[model samples]
Target: MNGMKIQITAELLDGLVLAILKQDDYYGYALTQRVQSVIDISESTMYPVLRRLKKNGDLTTYDQPFQGRNRRYYQLTAAGEQRLQEILRLWEQYKDNLDQIFYQRGEQQ
Candidate 1:
């Protein structure tokens, strides 16, 4: 109900988490922030995706002590990383096609 109202289904949220995991390992808050940068979903909506990824063995977590707190850090497993790479390649392809359709091309990175 807040932020941008994009039609994000469950699968898309999973994809978003996988996207961030591709870039770097992150704690819950950090992952939440990173995903928010891409899609305006809130922490509540995002946490379950992380949990589901860990549940489905696409992600792994370790507890690390930092800043006087023990935080659970999320990282992609080999399978998860592979999935990210595959999805990224597909996304790049989609964007390319979309740009051509929009036809106001300068360049996008």
Candidate 2:
């Protein structure tokens, strides 16, 4: 059986994309694929989230030609980058708290 995977909540996914864009600009399909590799999710499901992020002023997109086709790519705005960092910090703190809870409760069966 696969080990218990960390649940990638919707909010977490928003944060994840911003964090990834920090590394490099990526098209929607590429982002969907990359995110799915880490957590099982569909491209269709990803689009709305991306759209919402864009609407919220956290993402900016552009098109680039690659060989024969133009791909639409997304990048984190300064606001998005700052938001990602803040979310990461909070996640880390929450994780520490959860770890303490788990340890206090003892290992699962």
| Clash totals for all candidate models | 0, 0
RMSD of 2: 3.7
TM-score of each: 0.73, 0.85
TM-score of 1: 0.73
Encode model 1's per-residue lDDT on 1-109: one tens digit a residue. Answer: 3665757777667777887777888999998988878677888987888888898888999999999989999998988877777767877887798787699776566
On lDDT, the leading prediction is 2
Please name the candidate that would achieve the greatest TM-score relative to the true structure: 2
> How high is the CA lDDT of each candidate model?
0.82, 0.88
Give the worst 10-residue stretch by lDDT in candidate 2: 100-109
